[model samples]
Target chain A: MSRALGIEARDRRRAMLLTAPALVWTLVFFVLPFALMAAISLWQATATGMIRTWSLDNYTAFFTRPAYLGAALNSIEITVTVTVLSVLLAYPMAWIIAEEVPRRYQRLALTLAVIPFWTSYIVRSYAWSLVLSRKGVVNDWLAGWGLPLLDLANSRAAVVIGFTHFFTMLLVLTIYASLVQLPPNLRRAAADLGAGPVAIFRHVVLPLTLPGVMVGAFLTFALCIGDYVTPQILGGGKDLALPQLVMLQVGRRADLPMASALSIVLMALVTLAYLAMARWMKEPGK
Target chain B: MIRFAVSATYMALIYAFIFLPVYVLVLFSFQDGRFPIPPFKGFSLRWHQAVLSDGHLMAALGHSFVVAVLSSAVSLLLGFLAARGLAHARLRGAGVARGLITAPLSVSYLVIGLGLLASFNLANVPLSLMTVTLGHVVINAPLCFAICASAMGAPQLAAERAARDLGAGEIRVMALVTAPMILPALVAAFLLSMTFSWDEFIIAFLLSRFDVTLPVELWSLLRSGLNPKTNAIGSLVFLVSAFAVLAAELALRRRA
Candidate 1:
């Protein structure tokens, strides 16, 4: 036999041995820092610096001040809009690639779809700002059509467009992966059972791909809510997103405690997103 | 068919939408005027040449490269080892270990950066390129681990078992058998993390003092004014990244 008690012991030991360093690294860098931040969030940020006294003052302030609460609400609104919009846009493209494109060309088509994302993330936002600016390309194109100019730069709409552009690329790859994994015979079998194309798509294909869509949507939400660059460059820093508020606390005010509090709230939002995705994912299996 | 025509038109419109910003960015990088805005002047290469000569941008490029390479290497090594372990043996609490290792994937980069920043401030650790690398690893290592773990299923386990049955030592089997078997995953993990680190901004911006990465430098360049040099550098970045993605796809396609 290839397996024995001694070998089994060795295998288990080796597994532990192998995972130990990575676990240690994660503990030190990822987990410990989060723990530290949690502790610091409970502390107070004085004018001089951080103080050791435990207080809920930052969280209390976050609730009491309309600016902070409004930023959080705006972050949620923007993230949801971008997530749902990108998924809607991307699902069709991914479906086309999976269903319409020839097998050999599908790889190239997918690569082309995601190629724009390879650019510097910050540059992508800046480029969109240029395109959405009053005197930028969008307005220029409109002018050629004798249309009214659009003053979109430094607006929430500009931020949503930039974010949608990136997230759509991401969602396409994901949804395509799930789409291609469906066995061809399953669809053929459904057809043989006399199901119409639209019916098959709704009942069979959509249900199967829902998990992937949810995962992509959750990723979009997490990334969009935390992103400071898109809103900073395109939203023009006039209205602060949560990340911008956190950054302002750290960069201008040097309030580590307040930043930590803001980050904890950000983490909480992401955790809620994760839970929701997990709940939705469980339904597809049923 | 009407359906075919509809799909075609829709695809064309989407492609136009996808290419819009990139088209403008590249077109304006060659604009002959001071402003990057509309009313396109004649083409010129002055901004590209000027960006090439900018010392701070060049230095940031170098710093980004170093951080990408070094952090990716460390993350790949850790992730590969952990994946190999989880695949080979059933350690008690293996799920917990795996969860802990990959937990960072669920967290946002901003929150990760803020956590690191707060901890470093508390500990008085000076923010530097190393700190940025540390933050990148925290984010990228989990991703690397997930990719490696996914690629280490039945085939890999069989190969590793065959090597062990033939009397290969653990180290030899890992180095000579298991690793080579998952070499594609290792390479993919390394390359993908490099791409991420090279473009990552917030962690770099939050964790660095004097020596910033290219994205941070580009952000400042963008904010300092509306300069075509920013466009030039951005176009260059797009060019390199597009080439990398094309190369990776071609390589993987060939293998498949």
Candidate 2:
């Protein structure tokens, strides 16, 4: 019995040994850094250096400053628009690939759909800049057709379009996974109950895919809100997103306190989003 | 016939939207003029030649490769060990440990980058490739752990037990049995991490100095001018990443 207990003890020790490096790495790197950031957010950034005053001055500044508050609001508006537009556009594309395409070609079709995602994200945003610029391809085409120029190059609409492009592909993959997992019998059962195609889809398909849509939308919100490159490239400094504001704080002013506070605010938004979608974000089996 | 036509038209429009930027980017990379916009002057390889000859850009590319490979390797090792340990042993607070390990996956890269930048500032650590690589591992190890943990299941557990019963030492059981059993997952995790670390921008941007990654270099280039050289480099990156993605897809499909 003592030998068995010894074995148990040794197993536990081995487990600890094996997991220790990663746990310690996480604690030291991820958790500690986050703690330090949160702590620094309370400090004040002066012209000379950071003042470790341990106060709410930075947070208060974030609330009181119009530019800071506007950046947050702009981030929310763009993120919400991107998330909703992505879901609406991706649902049909995902449905087409899952239900309309042949089984052998579905994989190829999906791959083709998301191929541009592998491009350097910075480059992708820059490409959008080129497309939306005054003398760029879109305007040139419009001129060829004798239509008015879009005037979209350096605007919030440009940012939203760039974001929607990326997130639509992401949502398509997630919603496709959910749609494919749904057994065909559920649809057949609804059909046999005298439901038409639209009725069956509305009653059965939409509910079953809600979790996937929610997960994708949450992901879109999280990523889009924190992104710096897309808005910095596409929005052209005329409008500022939260991330660009954070970058401006760090890069130009060297204001770690302000940057930390802005980052925490950004994280708070993502946390709120996660909490709202927590119920539907789980894996289907789990 | 009308229904079929509508479906085809919709698919065509969506595909066109999806491929528009890529097409424009690649097409203008071969533009002969200084401007990358329309009125394609004609096809030329001057921009690609220019990118190849640029010393800073070449150095940044090398830095990106080294950081991506080394950071991904470290992340894969740590993730594999933690995953194997969690799967094989019944430890206290396993759920919490798992959560801690994988928590970085959900956080934005910008926040992670900012946090690291802040902490490094507090610690008086100078910004360099080493710091950038460390930041990459923090962002990527969680992904590696999640992938590896999901791939560990009953069949592998039985094999591990058999190896242990046959008098294999703990190290041998892992090296000889478990590693080979989960080779596909390990490779997948490693490749995925490499791709992410390679493409990661914000972390490397905030953490590095003097030795910038490709993305940062490209950002400065984009900021400096509106040249087709940026298009050339961007197209090159796209081609390389596309090749990697296709190879990974083929490999994973073959294994399945």
Candidate 3:
């Protein structure tokens, strides 16, 4: 009984030692910072960066202001559109990489997909701005063809185009990994039974790769919702996203409380979307 | 036959779409033009010449390199220790613990930067380049922990017991037996942390005042409109960083 008690105590001590670092790091860095932000959101800020008495003024101001609310709504709309587009584009690319191509070429093609992602995302977005600007390459080509000039930079369309360019590789890779893990025999068996290719895809391939689709969609949505740089560079100063608003309040306004309040709202909105997606994925049949 | 043709065509187009911007950036870097886009107005090395002369760009590049290297190094050390501790302990709540450790991986950099700013302000810590490095560490160490812990957790417990029974000290057992086993993961995590630190913009932008990173510098240059010199600099940075990632990936693949 004495020996057993000693061993149990030793085991417990070891467990505590193992888990302590991770717990402490998360508490101090992750949880504590967010908690501080939440607290700041409730306080009023002076111009001198001092906090005053707590109030709901920031939240109320957010609700009352059309511009802030509009920016938040635009973020949501962009995220949703980008998520859908990524899934549509990724599924086909994943299918080709996983099933259609030779193994050697598949490696090269997959590498190519990821190469764009390796470059600086900011630089890539800026490149899109250059290509889509009025005096840029896309319009230059249009003029040569006697087509109408396109000014996509600083427009909402530019955000969509930039995001699609930046994120499609990640979506493709995630979906491709899941797609490859699916047994080829299962797909072949479906074809062997009298199903057309599209039917087989709808019934067999789609269900099996739904997990990848969900993962890719989650990442894309999460990224788009949080992204500010892409919108700022491409949206042409006209369309303000949530992140830009948050930055403005914090950086220029020096209104940390307002910025904190706005960030918390953004966090809540994203959390709700994530939870919805989680539930939807869990109940795929419904 | 038609299906095959269609797939090939689309695949080519997709590859082109991905590569076009990269090609354009490189192409225009060599052009004698004054803008980011190209009209093929003969070749010149003027932009590269300009990049070479920019003292601010050089300083930022040096600062960025120091931060990336230092942050990755620090994160790798802390992560390895934590990962070893995680693997050795038979905790009941390990799953939840692991989830918390990996949570930083999914959180947006923007949110994390904002959180860092709020926390640092509350603590009355003056933000600087060092603070920016600390922010990177806080965000990246967990990433290293997750990667290293996953790799290390797969080892058999019996091996650890055997080392202990053989009279090896705890530190020696870890250094000789466990450390070697998780080296690949350590390397992978280090590479990832380096890449993340290099490409990082949001946190550095928010946290640092005096010394800005390359991404922040590039972003400021971009706000003024399309500059060909910006394109040249952006191309060089992209190529070097992409080469590093490619090399790391190849190394990882070989180890795997």
Candidate 4:
């Protein structure tokens, strides 16, 4: 009995050693950050950049301020819009890439999906500004046709367009990963069972790829909600996104308490969304 | 037949949507226009000249390269160690450990940047290129851990057992047998670390006191308004990143 107990002890020590590095990193960086942010959120900042003792003033101020709450809602609204758009665009692309094509084009198609990702996120947003600007190519083309050129530059439309460009690739890539994992035989079996193409897709493919869809939604929404550059550049100072507001508080106002409050709220929201995604989609393989 | 035609047309539009911004960025790099605005006056090398002549831009580029290299090296080393440790041990807490390691990947950069400042004193740490690299290590190590852990999992047991049976020491087995098997994963992790470090804005922006990275510089430039010179630099960065990713992808596939 003593020998067995000793062996068990030894095994446990090895396990602890294996897990130590990751634990230490998370404790120092992630958890500690949250703890600090939470503390700061409950405090107030003075004119001289001095932080006062703990109070619920910042959170109270946040809750009471219409602009702050509005910024938070705008973030949610933008995230929902981007997620819906990305999923719609990605579904068909993933379908074509998974079901309609020969295997030879898989690598090429995947490469195409990833190439845009290699470009800088801010650069891409700025490029959309170029393409959608009133005097830009799209408007110029429309002008030649004697049609009224739509002003997409520096509006909520610009944010959507920029996000679509940036995020559609991610959705397509993720959905493709899940789609490829599915056995082709499932689709064939559905066909042989006399289901129509749409029915087979609805019953077999959609349910199977639901995990990917959820993951894609999580990625897009999480990113869109926290995005500062896109809203700042594309929304042209008119769009009052939470991340942009947080940056303003930090950089311009130098109000650490307000910034901390905003960061904590944003982090909590994203963490909740991520947990929901994990619950729905636990495709650990991809 | 009409359905087929419509689908084909849709595919073409999707392709155009994907590639159009890229084409515009690349094309505008060559245009003689002073701004991103059109008229396409003529082709010239003036923008390239401006990009090359700016010392600040060049300095930012250099800083970015240094951070990328340092972060990639450190993250890959630490990650490889963690992966080997986890693989060798009959661990009970591996799931919790893995969860902790991957948590950084999901956290937003704004929160991370804010958190780092709130947690640490800048006077002691004194944000610089060194601090920026440290921040990169903090954010990027988890990515390496995830990639290397999966890569090392299935194929490692054979090599480890073989080395032990051959009377090799633990370090010898790791350096010779385990390292070879996981080399591709190491490469992938390093490339990913490099990419993340190069592109990372928030942490670097928040932490840097003097030595700013290219992304931060480019962002500041944007606030000052766009120029042809910025386009020139943007195009160059896009080219380098795309090439690196392509090379890394090919190398990974070949090894597989």
Candidate 5:
């Protein structure tokens, strides 16, 4: 029995040893950095450097400054628009891929849908900038068709368009996974009960796949809200999202305290999103 | 018939919308003229040649490759060990450990980059590729851990037990038995991490100084001016990454 106890103890030690490196890495890199950021957020930024005095000056400034608050609002607006548009657009594509496409071709179709995602994200946004430029493809194409050119470059619309394009692909993948996992018999059963296609879809298909939609939407919110590249490249300098604001504070102002506060705010938004979507974000079999 | 037609049209439009930017970017990269905008001005390889010869861009590319590979390899190793330890051992606080490892996934890249930058500054560690690589590891390791942990199952546990029963050492059981058993997961984790690290902008942007990554270099290039060279470099990155994604998919499909 003592030998068995010794074996168990040794195994426990081994497990600890195996997991220690990762734990330590996460502690030193991830947790400690986040803690430092939170701590720095409370510190006051002075002319020469950060003052050790703990204050709410940065957070207060964020709330009181119209530009800062506007940036936050812009971020929320863009994120919401992107999330909603992505879901609306992706649902049909995901539905078509799962329900309409031939089984053998479904994988190919999905791959083609998300092929652009393989491109560098920064480049993708830059590509959008080129595409939406005054003398760019869309305008050129419009001119070809005798249509009036629209000014989209460096606008919130352009940012939304860029974000929607990427998130649509992501949402399609997630929603498609859930759609395909749905047992076909459920639909057949609904049909046997004399429910029409729309009714069956609304009641059966939609409810079952709502979790996937929620998961995808929440992810979109988390990513889109915190993204600096998309807005910086596409939103032009006319408008600033929260992330752009954070970068501005860090890069130009060298206000580490303000940047940290802004980051904490952004983190809080993501945390709130996660809490809201917590029910549907669990592992599949969980 | 009308519903089918509508769906087909919608799909076509969406596909067009999705491919528009990629199409424009690639087409303009070959433009003989300076501007990357319309009026193709006939195809030319000048921009591609320019990208290939530009020492700064090439150096940035090499730096990106090194950071991606090293960070991804470290992430995969740490993730695999953690996943294995959690899967096999009925240890206390496993749930907490898993949570801590996977928590970074929910956080944004900007936030992670900012946090690391702050911490590194506090430590008086000057920004370099090493710091950028460390930042990448911080972001990607959680992802690797999640992927590896999800792929662990009863079959691998049984195989591991069998190896142990055969008087194999713990390290041998892990290296020779468990590792091979979850090779697909490991590959997937590594490839995914590498892909993220390669294209990751914010962390590398915030951390690196002289040895900037490709995305950071591209950012400066984009800011410097509107040149077809930017288009060429972007196209090149797209082509290489697309090839990698295709290869990974093919490998995973074959394994499955």
Candidate 6:
């Protein structure tokens, strides 16, 4: 019995040795850094350096300042619009790939849908900028057609277009995973129950898939809200999003405290989103 | 019939939308004139050659490759060991350990970047490629852990046991038996991690001082001018990364 207990202890120690590196890594790089950020968020940014005073002055400034508040609002508006539009757009595509395509070709269809995602992300946004620039293809085509050309490169419309383009692919990937997992018998059962198509969809298919869709939507919100490049490249400097605002604090202003505070605000928004979506995120009790 | 037609047309249009920017980016990279816009003067490889020759862009590409490869290697190692450990020992609080490793995935890159920026400043660690690589590992290790952990099932565990019972050392069992058992997950995690670290922007942007990743350099290049050169570099990166993706898919398919 003693020998057995000794062997068990040795195994336990070995396991700790194996896992300790990653656990320590997370604690040092992720958790500790986050703690430092939260601590710095309360400190004051001064011309010389950060003042050691523990106060919410930076947070207060974020609330009171129009530039900061406007940027946060812009972030919220754009994120919501993109998430909604992406779901609406991607659902049809995902549905088509899952339902309309032949069995053997579905994989090809999905791969084709996801192929563009492999492009360097910044280049993807820059590509959109080129497509929508005033002197770019759309406008050139418009001029040839004698239609009024749009100056879209530096606008909210452009930012939304860029984000929606990316997130639609993401949502399709997620939503399709859930859609494919759905057992076909459930639908057949509903059909045999004398239910019409709409009735079957509303009662059976929608309920089963809504949770998965919500999860994807939550992912969209989390990703869309925190993105800097999409808005930075597409929105231009005309409209600053929250991330751009945070970068402004760090880059031009060299205000690390202010940047930290803005980062906390961004995280707060994500935490709130996670809380709202917590219902769908729970695993089914097995 | 009507529904099928509508769906077909819709799929066609969506595919068009998806490929539009890629098409235009490639097309205009060959624009003979300075402008990358329409009225495609003619085809020329001048801009691609320009990117190939530009010293800064080339250096940034090298930096990106180093960061991606090194960071992914580290991430995969740490992740695989952790997955192996968790799967082997019935240790208390293993759930919490798993959660801690995966928590970073839920956080945004901006938050992670800003947090690291603050930490480096507080610790007086100078921003450099080292710091950027560290941040990439943080973001990517969690992904690798999830992939590896999911692939570690009863079959792999039983195989490990069999190897151990045959008097194989712990390290030997892990290297020779368990790893080969779940090679697909390791390959997937490594490639996925590499791709992510390769394309990661905000962290590399905020962490590095003199040396920057390709995306950050592309960002500055885009900001510096609106020219065909940017299009050229962007197309180059896209094609290279796309090939990596296709190769990854083929590898995984054949392995499966």
Highest DockQ model number: 6
Candidate 3 clashes between residue pairs 3 or more apart in a chain or in different chains = A154-A235, A154-A236
lDDT of 1 by residue, B108-210 (tens): 8888898888788778999999999999999899888998898788887888789888999889998998778777767777888888899899999999999
lDDT of 4 by residue, B1-256 (tens): 7856766676667778888888787778778877866766778888888888899999999999999999889887767777777766667767777777778788888888888877766235677888788789888888888888888766687777777778987678878988888788788788878988888887888878888999989888887666677678888888888877877787588777
Better candidate by DockQ, 3 or 5: 5
Off by over 4 Å in 2: A279-286
Q: Looking at candidate 3, what is the lDDT of residue B116?
A: 91
| lDDT, model 2, position A116 | 93
DockQ of 4: 0.61
True contacts kept of each: 0.85, 0.75, 0.53, 0.55, 0.83, 0.88
Q: Compose the digit string of candidate 2's lDDT tens values, residues A98-143.
A: 9888999999889999999999999999899999898999999999
What's the TM-score of chain B for every model shown?
0.94, 0.96, 0.92, 0.94, 0.97, 0.97
Overall lDDT per candidate, in order of appearance: 0.88, 0.90, 0.82, 0.81, 0.91, 0.90
Those runs of model 3 whose alpha carbons end farther than 4 Å from true positions after fitting are A1-15, A284-286, B153-156
Candidate 4 Cα errors over 4 Å, as ranges: A1-19, A278-286, B122-124
Q: Which residue pairs collide in model 2, if any?
A: none
lDDT of 6: 0.90
- Screening candidate 1 with a backbone cut-off below 3 angstroms (N, C-alpha, C), the clashing residue pairs are none
TM-score of chain A for the candidates in order shown: 0.94, 0.96, 0.92, 0.89, 0.96, 0.95
Q: What is the lDDT of residue B189 in candidate 5?
A: 81
| Per-residue lDDT of candidate 6, residues B187-222 (tens digit) | 888888888998999999999999899999998998
Which candidate, 4 or 6, has the higher TM-score?
Answer: 6
Q: Provide the RMSD of all predictions against the true structure, rounded to 1 decimal.
A: 2.2, 2.0, 2.0, 2.8, 2.2, 1.9
Query: Residue B246 of model 5: what lDDT?
Result: 80
Better of 1 and 6 by lDDT: 6
Model 5 misplacement above 4 A? A279-286
- Please give the TM-score that candidate 5 achieves against the real structure: 0.97
- CAPRI verdict (incorrect, acceptable, medium, high) for model 6: high
Candidate 2: Cα lDDT at B71 = 93
